[model samples]
Target chain A: MHIATRMKTRTQGGITEVLVLVNHPMDTGLVKSPITHKIIPAHFIKTLTIAINHKPAVITDMGIAVSKDPLIAVKLKGAKSGDLVSVDWIDNEGMTGHAETHVS
Target chain B: MNLPRRTFLKQAFSGTALAVAAGAGLLRPTQALARTWPTWPAQSFHIKHWRDLEHSLFGSKPVVSGGVHLHAPLEAENGAVVPMVISTKLAAPKRLALAVDHNPYALATLVNLTPHALGFFNVRIKMGKTSRVRAYVETADRVHTVDRLVKVTIGGCGG
Candidate 1:
């Protein structure tokens, strides 16, 4: 599945909120492959990590039960709007994708 | 002619009994409801469509609150790709999930957020037709749901 991400930042109560959007198929082992006429094996991003300035901000572990092209939002401390936040994710099939956003 | 009278009486009696049996509760209803409701056999898109309103996800319950917001196009030109967004106003959220009804399998995606992250997300989804998009949120030791409808003009999922 093709993946892409975008992030937005806002401040509340002295904390920065980081929002993210990711593009992916996240096939849940139910869709059939047209050529094979067989169920496409479950392959999806199982883990997602958000780091602010290379520090661990958030980590998420997912399963096949999730929807396609999942979107995630998070809140972090010590980061302000207009700061750089990095995101990295790994799927069950061992494929990895990364993205970055300026906190705003 | 004498032999025919007994046969006719017996036939009449049996017919009356059969009619009575048919009218009583012993017979099943003539019009049975179809069982087309969604079902999840193996937690996939083809078996059951995800519904946040129904609270059918694993390890989560459905709640309604102002913190959860879901956005999608009122009408989609292509079911193959529909844009969607889910945002929350909660202070600290633990988990977020999205489900689509009308696809072969309903549970479309799940997003787990970090402890120190804002509650906002955006993504693209595949739709089969006009379906309900549900957002599931876990916070304050409970689960909540917010839903919106999306209409698809073109068939997706290889339909």
Candidate 2:
């Protein structure tokens, strides 16, 4: 998979906390050839969608500034152990990446 | 040239000695001490106020800050990538957005929310330079905002 996700869900006092870490280069287009000195056109994720049970939960727009392999943490009050949580991202170059896992 | 003798002596004793040594032709300037220059976008980012940013991004100015907490680092090691999080006590938000006041595009993202958020959200955004990041959230009733300054290291935009 182009995107690998690590996620976990824990329920405590009726609140479910979701932790996410996505693996990607998140290239900010800042690096260029030492010889040519051309700008390394920024290539990074633009949109990130978090959905629970196929319903959109949180949607974020990313900038060229996000670091490689981003981390996201959220707390969902009513989510359970079996609900399906999906994360999807679209890069600036239009390349899309996605991954899904169950809350446990 | 305006440096005091003690300062010059300190630099001469410290790292600037190489630049001094280069002047004497004792050594060639090395890449180890090469300078890295940061470049802001050619077009300047201009916004008169946070309300202006809100008006441009969300159509109307927001209410005073309440119920929303923005978590971010006080200082960022790199300007290109910064970590951000927004948490709130609102029941059901209609949308939320993040903005860096000095970025080429201040409005980073505005997401239509679901009741599922339970008021906590996280994401990472890039900062072209050091600036205040404001998080605005619109619920069924009103809008709330929270902001903080995030300092950046020089030449961090991949100079």
Candidate 3:
């Protein structure tokens, strides 16, 4: 459940968009080892939540079927030019990753 | 006396004509039928993870959103790493996720944003085969999702 993330922002039509990419294997346990012929145990991000300036914004419940290195995009409320946004997530196995970006 | 011979000959000719027509129709439409729309499985799904979202066990749910857009190649040369992008058009967005059908694990990625997030993301993923990629966006009060199909040339995950 090791996680890594990157964030970016852009302005369009007076609104700001935030994009993020996360890295993880997200193994679904259904996959078998190519050589050993054994099924890999299911492991993926289970719960994810987002906050803006310490306010809860979004939360998600996930399972093992999610793809590896999932990417996410979200829009923030009241985000204007020149603001700093913070992003973070935790996986079912308790691994966490965080990133930040400045709005332009 | 001669009536029977003439009648038999007429019937045989008509029957042969019908068979030829049927064979021509099959050849003309076979390729079109091959590209028919995808169908959901018939049985019920007992999905324990995101990867099983397309099976009969996992029911279909409507996803709503106005800001999230998902972009990926319509056809991928490799199943091991297909490039994709998800972008939000909202002024400020709070959450984003990627869901896929026909993959062992369907939920591919999730991201939480702080106040400064502008709502855009990109990455590459291993696809089991051909699949529809779905992007879920969570804003202040609602969740929205958009989907696109990506055909994988090679099976990812050693499928």
For candidate 3, write residues A1-104 as lDDT tens digits: 23567778676876656666677777767778888989987666555444444344444445554447666555555666766665555554556566666777
lDDT of 3 by residue, B34-124 (tens): 2331221212123424435422222344346456788899998878678778877765566666767776556665555555445666556
Task: Estimate the lDDT of model 3.
Answer: 0.61
Of candidate 1 chain B, the 10-residue stretch with the lowest lDDT total is B29-38
TM-scores vs. true structure, each candidate? 0.59, 0.70, 0.53
Residue-pair clashes per prediction, in order, are 26, 3, 33
- In model 2, state the lDDT of residue A50: 71
Error at B42, model 3, angstroms: 22
Off by over 4 Å in 2: A28-35, B1-52
Candidates in descending lDDT order: 2, 1, 3
Higher-scoring candidate on DockQ, 1 or 3: 1
lDDT of 1 at B138: 79
Predicted model with the maximum DockQ: 2
lDDT for every model?
Answer: 0.65, 0.68, 0.61
Residue-wise lDDT of candidate 2 within A8-88, one digit each (tens)?
A: 677788787777787877765657757788866776666676778866677665655456777877676678878887766
- Candidate RMSDs in Å, in order, are 21.3, 19.3, 22.1
**Could you tell me the TM-score of chain B in model 1?**
0.63
Looking at model 3, give its docking quality level. Answer: incorrect
Deviating ranges (above 4 Å) for candidate 3 = A1-4, A11-13, A35-37, A58-67, A101-104, B1-70, B83-99, B105-125, B132-148
Candidate 1: clashing residue pairs, number: 26
